[model samples]
Target chain A: MTHTDNGFSATRRLILQGASAVVLVGLGNLPFGLAPAFAAANDKYPEEAFKAKSEADAIKALYGKTPEASDKVKMDAPEIAENGAVVPVSVTTTLPDVTSISFLVAENPVALVASYKIPAGTMPSVANRIKMAKTSNVIVVVEAGGKLYSATKEVKVTVGGCGG
Target chain B: MASTIRVRATSSGETTEVQALIQHPMDSGFVKDAKGEIIPPHFIQQLTFEYDGKPVFTADWGGGVSKDPYVKFAFKGGKKGDELKVSWTDNKGASDTTTAKIQ
Candidate 1:
């Protein structure tokens, strides 16, 4: 009888301990749950409103003005991308007095993709891969000698790069 | 951040060729989270190369690509002492640009 009572008490204690641990974890998560609310309170702008519907929109948002289309910017990409996740891209330019380079995706949220400030006496060239949520035009903008020149290329995203 | 970008420039007579590689996750938002929810797409969309205050190349990209996209190209009239600057931007509005000297 004594042994049976001891076993029962030990089991009860174990259950209580488990319950307390669960309560502690729940309390710990409460702060995390409130974090989003705090973030929303601090947000002043509708961040999604800045998303670009096309490559043009992205450029406008980036420089606060329109960029002139120029042949000097060479945008190399596959006409048809087999995979929507990884597309190889290369951009070369022969523009003189180049000071900066940038890239943008037209159909993405907040399209002004990347920018590079070229130091004096450096070669102006860049290559990289970009993800597409869907089929869209890729745009390149170059700030050369204080003037901005741009180019665009249409890329077809057959498979959804963003989960559909 | 503080990642190494490998740059190689080859010269044949007057023409100079350049190649570069950067370490980036190139995360595609279509991936799933641990709970199987589709993660939003994030990717690099633009890149540019400049040599000695001259724009040599520029590229535009989209989602139908893979992670850590590798790029290679050639240009005419690059010298051995030229500076090659590379920069990129992503869909999330994040940007990074780095420079490599032609060797």
Candidate 2:
């Protein structure tokens, strides 16, 4: 059928675009010729990654690879958070060609806190507020130059953030 | 309804800095209300910032993010008086978008 041929061509084009679009993530398996039209739409949400209950599973779901620990990935977090509901965390990486950064809480019910995509020309630093259920180690992962690096720190919470 | 997003974009010659604060409960579904019933998860799943029609920064968030989330980042090549677009879509499919002029 002619429609089959069109679908094949469209899929090929989508693959090519995915290869070039560093801003997009985890969207390669979307089917149908209509998928390419969505290239301009919002990026696909990683529902599975957010649902991972541990840090290691989350990192694998999001990036499909493991990251090496590195000192260059600097994480700024409070030694003790007065309010667990709004613990301010940030990261700045000295690594080159940084493409993405992610946060994970080793003790939270869902370990993955936040993940960010850094396009070309964007600075390699990001700051945000997150929640911690209790005292836990906060890990930051930086993806740079086709490789992944990470840093971690312990943050103590006086009170629980996920509703004690 | 008034938009729930508040954004400020400032360009300093070479780099542009953006800070945004969004009003949302960001409920992690792990909490209970006064009646002891569980609160279902309601959180923003994705937030994007676009300049010159290209995404400079994008955030994929989970319920672990704080309520009324605030985030900051910077990128190169944004010009003064230009426009930057900020938008977010929550898990329930609710979305809000707004544009801010660079200063």
User: Highest lDDT: which candidate?
Assistant: 2
- Superposed on the true chain A, the predicted chain A of model 2 yields a TM-score of 0.75
Q: Tell me the spans in candidate 1 whose CA falls farther than 4 Å from its real position.
A: A1-57, B1-18, B28-30, B38-66, B69-103
Per-residue lDDT for A27 in model 1? 89
Candidate 2 Cα misplacement greater than 4 A, ranges: A1-42
Of candidate 2 chain A, the 10-residue stretch with the lowest lDDT total is A22-31
Report how far off residue A96 is in candidate 1 (Å).
Answer: 1.3
Q: How do the residues B1-103 of candidate 1 rate in per-residue lDDT, one tens digit apiece?
A: 5844566777775667777775655555546878988667665666667777655765554443456667666677776776788877777887777777676
Question: Best DockQ goes to which candidate?
Answer: 2
TM-scores, each model vs. reference: 0.53, 0.85
Pull out the clashing pairs in model 2. Answer: none
Fraction of native contacts (fnat) of each candidate: 0.32, 0.94
Per-model TM-score of chain B? 0.84, 0.98
How does chain A of every candidate compare to the true chain A by TM-score?
Answer: 0.63, 0.75
